[model samples]
Target: MKKDLRFLVVDDFSTMRRIVKNLLHDLGYANVQEADDGKTALPLLQAEPFDVLITDWNMPGMPGLDLLKAVRSDPKLAKMPVLMLTAEAKRDQIVEAAKAGVNGYVIKPFTAQVLAEKLEKILAPAA
Candidate 1:
């Protein structure tokens, strides 16, 4: 995975976003943008090119699942990688995310190592 890839980290709580952003930074991904919710994230995604999206499942507005669906539905953004970094841990919700086209999923209260591994797995070129 490239260190310079652009990343968007979306979460309703500013603290979570900050934590994720800091983790990404520590992982050498400095080009990270933040949005408070999917409603805010979708517009930024539509406006610019983001290499990866790390989103929380619950939010005040459009949730991460809807954002993932919208991204998958958009011709321009369909292929962009999405990682659901959330607290939602139900098996059904994980399955739903897979069905909706999320490239990766990481439960909340995650470690920097876990985040790095998921990102690397998703961004790795297939052999």
Candidate 2:
């Protein structure tokens, strides 16, 4: 069921974005989109109906936390599941993301298996 769900992956680095996209592809999720930063992602989120969001915490213009807050505040996008994949492993950051309504958290550098597990856990009920 999750194989067809649209996913938006936001990150500052192109290499990281490609890596995540490839991992998603390996996990059987081919409908994935990429954004260089939260600012770029916001417009896409507002304009499209994405089932899931995978974002990095640190980004230029707007950070993932702010993006999560924005999504949560918008009635149209509030219910979409969000997974935060970032290098920020601090407890406070994780707590902040949780408070901001992120559905899952993954600390980098992560394995494809770990990413698959996180995606499965987040998308399981919907599937």
Candidate 3:
């Protein structure tokens, strides 16, 4: 993963956002931003350029899935990499995210190593 790449961490809980931000910082990604929910996140996404998006699934309004769909549908943001870091671990939910074009998915309570691995996988060039 590019150390300088901009990241957007979206979650409803402030503590969760801070935890994710801290993890990313530990992983050597310093340029990070936070959004409380997808409704708030959408505009930032549209207004700015973010290399990666790490979002939770259960937000009050717009949720992560809807945000992913919106990003996929928008021509400008269509190619953006989205990594779902959510507590929702249902098989169907994972399948739906994959079908919707998520670059990666990590269930909550993930370790820093898991996050690093997922980032590497998503950012890796196609073989």
Choose the strongest candidate by lDDT.
Answer: 2
User: Least lDDT summed over 10 consecutive residues: which range in candidate 1?
Assistant: 118-127
As a whole number from 0 to 100, the lDDT of residue 116 in candidate 2 is 85
Instruction: Give the deviation of candidate 3 from the true structure as CA RMSD.
Output: 1.7
- Better structure of 2 and 3 per lDDT: 2
* Best-to-worst ranking by TM-score: 2, 1, 3
In model 2, the Cα lDDT at residue 58 comes to: 94
Lowest lDDT 10-residue stretch of candidate 3: 118-127
lDDT of each: 0.92, 0.93, 0.92
User: Tens digits of per-residue lDDT for model 1 on 1-127?
Assistant: 5788999999999999999999889988899999999999999999998988999998888999999999999999999889999999999999999999999999988888899899889888631
lDDT of 2 by residue, 23-112 (tens): 988888899999999999999999998999999999999999999999999999999999999999889889988988999999999988
In candidate 1, how many Å is residue 111 off?
Answer: 1.0
Q: How far is candidate 2 from the true structure (C-alpha RMSD, Å)?
A: 0.8
Please, what is the TM-score per model?
0.96, 0.97, 0.95
Of candidates 2 and 1, the better by TM-score: 2
Off by over 4 Å in 3: none
Candidate 2: worst 10 consecutive residues by lDDT? 1-10
List residue ranges in candidate 1 displaced over 4 A: none
